[model samples]
Target: MKSLVALNSNDPELYLLLRHILEAEGYDLRLLVDVEDLDHLLKVGRLHAVILDCTPDNESSLICARLKLGGQSTPVAALIPSDGNAQYMKLIKAGVDEGMLRPLAPSRLLQFLRHQPNGASADGELGVLAEGKSLRQHVLEMDLEAQRVRYNGRHFGLPPIGFRLLACFLKSPNRILSREHLIAAAWRDTACVKQRTVDIHIARLRRRLHAITGSEMIRTVRFVGYVLQPHKNTRNPGSDVFQRG
Candidate 1:
């Protein structure tokens, strides 16, 4: 069964509508009334995607941010009020997969769900995404299966958390990954880790990659998070060098 996480507080009508729509399409829906409930549900569920109802009182953006931080791979779709582009931007920065306006049409919800990864049970998992095999110095290439880093033909093994964090940056090169997203990607299960834990891992990854490539492979955007910036001379205009998610 395809599991889901829905965030909306006290809107029985909205919940009922979603239940009917999703049940008809053969989905097992899990309703989340608040952030705490959503956090609890995520621990035991292999979710497909999250449907966030963006009512004025519904803090869907914050909730989605927390879920993304917790390593939940479920794609998030935010339902905003018609005039709520500001909220939409916030959701996007929080790593939401898509956004729609309320009252949500059943067809739209189904459309978003259809595009998500079919999970491992369907057609096998999505493999490592790469632009090409030949990686240049200072550029990032991930072995998604082995969680190894290959730069300038040298290999550097990564810890599980570091690998996940680097994968987030590789998947979205040049985009600023906020500290919240990094934390969600690195330490999603526990809230006890110091916020500096992300910094520690990033620093370690940076040093290791630099040592292997003999160049600064990762750049830190002040007040923002890290990004993988390839050397200008190494870029191939026609060749696929950097992979994008």
Candidate 2:
């Protein structure tokens, strides 16, 4: 059977372009202009994937969050404006699998769809929680499936961005991660994110970790970026130890 994909968009041009591309590739395309219909459609049928047009108001981000929180595993891609840095971040935090800049190329759209669940490159891995895998770093354990972190025998929830930021740190423990690198990993290459924004988020993440570990796991490099120390170390003077930046 051909794969069925849904496009929730109000742009006629996008609809026509994607319909041509998808039908030519032997896929079934469904266009939905009204957001109200999405819930009903989800109840009645199965979709291989969903592509959303992320408007300035970001109604689509809410829809993507609903889909994920409702236990739907369908992959969601969003078409966003090139300069919509804030909107792009919101979409990613809302569980969008991919974001493509608007005036999108046909090749890019095709490539994204082809890697979806039942698409040509479907590798059975969906999101950050791929294959129920968990990431570990010293005393910190991240349950990707649960979107929670375990430390000191307690489980705590983090915002999606926080979770991703910590995952990046865990992947490269005991290494200094520049603000640029953390932005790329946590915000998915949103170039307009200010350095201060990274500082704020890192401060918030530090507070979350501090609540659990009661010791500093992240250290500031003074004019450089921050480093993740997997094992607790209080020997370093002038570290971000117990102090929120």
Candidate 3:
């Protein structure tokens, strides 16, 4: 099937440019001027990717957050202003997959879409995850392609940073992960992220995991860091599984 991409943009010129380019490359493009329309489409349609025009007043970042929180892993790319560092950071934290600086190049947008696992060619061949396999520990499984976490038969979505932090913890289960290690794993622009930010996102991840498993799977180690513990109901529930590193 031809990949379908949704463009949430008010710019007629940019829409025309992307439609022409994507169609030529064997993709179908849908242009949406309203955020409500985009949200509705997301609920009913299978979008390979979403392109957002991050106008100063637009809720592109908010939309990105909603899409991720709602368990939709469709790739989202934002067209941001040339000097939109603050906006870019907001979108990243909101779970946007990519951001292209405006005066946006059609080629760059095409390249971004082509790189997404969902953005396959007209021949229907699927793309692969560059990160390789899903991380599994006990009953918890992180589906990289679906971008959701499964725990004890329940599935849930997380913000991008939350997802990465959980992946780090899962990769080294029962081992303490320092803030620096988590920052390296979770944030692309780590220099600006403080240790406190890591704590906050970890708290969020912990809450989500708790909601799914109904037990504290992550244990904080004072000034050291945090470790992922096996579920309380698992075999040897009282065992000392947490390893400090």
User: Please, what is the whole-model Cα lDDT of each candidate in the order they appear?
Assistant: 0.62, 0.70, 0.72
User: Which regions of candidate 2 deviate over 4 angstroms?
Assistant: 56-58, 82-93, 123-171, 183-245
Q: Which stretches of candidate 3 lie over 4 Å from their true place?
A: 24-26, 65-75, 85-134, 143-148, 155-162, 178-180, 186-204, 219-226, 235-245
Ranking by TM-score: 3, 2, 1
Worst 10 residues of 3 by lDDT: 121-130
RMSD of each: 10.4, 8.0, 5.6
Q: Candidate 3 lDDT, tens digit per residue, 1-245?
A: 77888887778888898899899997889886666877877766788888888876667777788777777878787787756767767776776765566787677677666645555652211122225456677777776655567776678766556777887887788899899988877665454566866776787788878888888989999999999987648534333343221
Lowest lDDT 10-residue stretch of candidate 1:
119-128
Between the candidate structures 1 and 3, which one is better when assessed by lDDT?
3
* lDDT for residue 121 in candidate 3, whole number 0-100: 50
Who wins the lDDT comparison? Answer: 3
After TM-score superposition, the amount by which residue 72's alpha carbon in candidate 1 deviates from its true location, in angstroms, is: 2.7
Which pairs of residues have clashing backbones in candidate 1? 69-184
Q: In model 1, which regions exceed 4 Å deviation?
A: 119-245
For all predicted structures, in order, the TM-scores are 0.51, 0.56, 0.64
